[model samples]
Target: MLSLAGWSVLIQASLAAIPSYVMQCAYLPGKILDGVDRVNRNFLWGSSDSAKKVNWVGWDKVTKSKEERGLRLHSAKGRNIALLAKLNWRFQIESEALWVKVLKMKYSIKRGRDIFNKGSRWLVGKDSGLNVWHSNWTNGGSLRKLIHGPITQEASFLEVKDIMLDTGWDWGKIPFEISLEIKRMIQAIPVTILSRGAGKLIWAGSPQGTFDLRSAYRLAMGNNMVFNKKNRNSSLALEIVRQALEYYHCVASPRLQTCKVLKGIRWERLPQGWMKLNTDGSANGNPGLAGCGGVIRNDAGQWVVGFSKCIDITSSFVAELWGLREGLILCCNLYITSLEIELDAKVIVDILNKPAYVNNIISPILDDCRLLASRIPQIRVKHCFRQANRCADSLARMSVSLDSVFSSFHSSPVDLLDVFEDDFNGVNVNKLCPEPDVPL
Candidate 1:
């Protein structure tokens, strides 16, 4: 019933109109659009379900504008793309639109990010990464308030890059104008000039320097900079304490692990041809008035030799080393061939058993003790509890009143007679942790 021009008009006004309208709202699958195109082709060519005719122009060319010398037809795919692009442009331009506000709320930084900014700090990987006074590096706060007086013109724009050296921190770049406390705190932080590029910012609120909302909230609620600083300080202190405890457990626990009750412990007499030497050291305070005492005994549990030396103010470690060294020297002088050494200090016992660590103050004494021990034909060093070492402890405590640097007693002193007799009798006392009336 329809001619070619009439078929074309019918296809445009009816068949293409429906899909073009749908394309403006949403994309139509390519296969569905292709089926519509097939129908349009069949209609234009006067083909029907009964028979088919050749399609003269490809659908692509048919869909081109009239200037391209083909029937102008709406492309379902093209219409979908143009609609989407227009919508996107509109949303961007209309700043006060509902969708724009919704997106801003979803993605934009709010007050939470401000608190996050306060918690962020620069980790130094490269020299130029941080501005000295402007950056948050020292104690999770800046050096702005800590610095005293007017900042010099040349130093106004000072950066971490200018003050670091290959060897370490450049002390020369440090301003003498700042307080000594500020200088000390700055020097305490290590800087390496080994890395390249501006270092990244890290969240100082977390232990790993990662950003988290929990720490940010706490930091935000903090009263002021000092409050925030205290929080950071407490975190740092906890970490340091954990590390110290680990080191102590590794070095001391093995030697010091003791029975809570003294009923499980007692001093014993040495075997024939063996000499037992008990040594102890005491400090009024760890680094205050210190002293060392040692007593050597025979198989009969009779005192062979006893000595006490008043060491000047020093650490308990140095004082313990002093006692052991003196005992070894006494044995070497007397040519006591077979000997067993006992000390109540686990730390000293640990030091003796392991290879000596290099210490500026304690190494010399430690080295002497090792050398003297090696000279003997036989030696055994062990850790003993305070209950087993009472005589030597009492003697060490007595050194606090001694005027002489060193003193020796051939006979058991009257003050330590009870402790000496108790040892000879293998007496035991009730020494326990949470020890009442007993030193920890």
Candidate 2:
């Protein structure tokens, strides 16, 4: 006999997948979804044809996450809409895709595009291409529609660049009389330009300026969704369900085996012809004192050059880029043609690899990294585990204590010699891996 947790796993793995494939592209009928939900409830409660059991908590409650005191089994209807929203997001962003192009040619494709546009805006560059009045750069609509009165044709033709300065909004250059509130509103909006590429449209909801299904679905469904159940002893019933859920975790499906396994992680040397660069960044707190450090080593793991710089208060991401930027600059100065770059942070490596995905704040340093990288004929960017880049990580941590300055080391730093020696000797660092599950 399967426990409640076992049933939860069985339903999630085998039963729930039945409708998910079709639900993404097409909407299933209400009857079909209801039928599926009925089956799931029956199966979950161990209801048989001979003996039907009463559903203590509502099906809606069961579909909610653990935080909400539920099993986190997705409702077919909600899952369908979220999945379709993802497709709609992809259609807008990936216009060049063959599927999107074909759909565009065959159908008008205007279903959710308008709704998505309402929540999105232009990631402004130099402000030349975008019109001061006509561009879809503001929160909801264009400046022309947002403003109450109509202006002269010549005045209306003004572009964003005409009223923008290097520092901020050029008040004197603004031709028409705008209210103080409107001026402040325009000034608050960031109009940033990168070294390469023009302004791109991005979803305003996400920090990365990309459309995510979770955020989209949350926005679509409304953020504050409360599930209210009208049943006697609801709190007592939920406690019973929780106890049932935890009943089998130790003895049933989780079936844990405790065995010590050695996860040997070591700093890898580059190819004979290529030099490896390991860079890392550290901060006392995210927005507190930040710094970066990096080291360049040959094929035999012998350090050629290294640097440590203590940057004042900044984000960890910026600190990471600073280390990479300094390393690239060093490589350029030394004319190191063949290079392999390694960093513990994977996102920075991704941004470096995909230049089209630009964030205005990081563009300046990212542009520098790109430009410096372009100088080198052969270059490879890779992500390494934090354990593998211990030497560089230690250097980065050390920079936090030093005064704000860029210091270069011809040889290994005195404090970092132990880790450096371990790395050079190809010594493996001991890491305890999670114990495997013991089968009954």
Instruction: Identify the leading candidate in terms of lDDT.
Output: 2
lDDT value, candidate 2, whole model:
0.74
Off by over 4 Å in 1: 1-262, 433-440
Predictions: Cα RMSD each: 26.8, 10.2
Clashing pairs in 2: none
Compared with the true structure, what per-residue lDDT tens digits does model 2 show for residues 137-191? Answer: 7543587776787777877777776776654567776567777556644643444
TM-score of each: 0.41, 0.49
C-alpha lDDT values of all predictions: 0.68, 0.74
Candidate 1, residue 126: how far the Cα is off, in Å:
46
TM-score of candidate 1 against the unseen true structure: 0.41
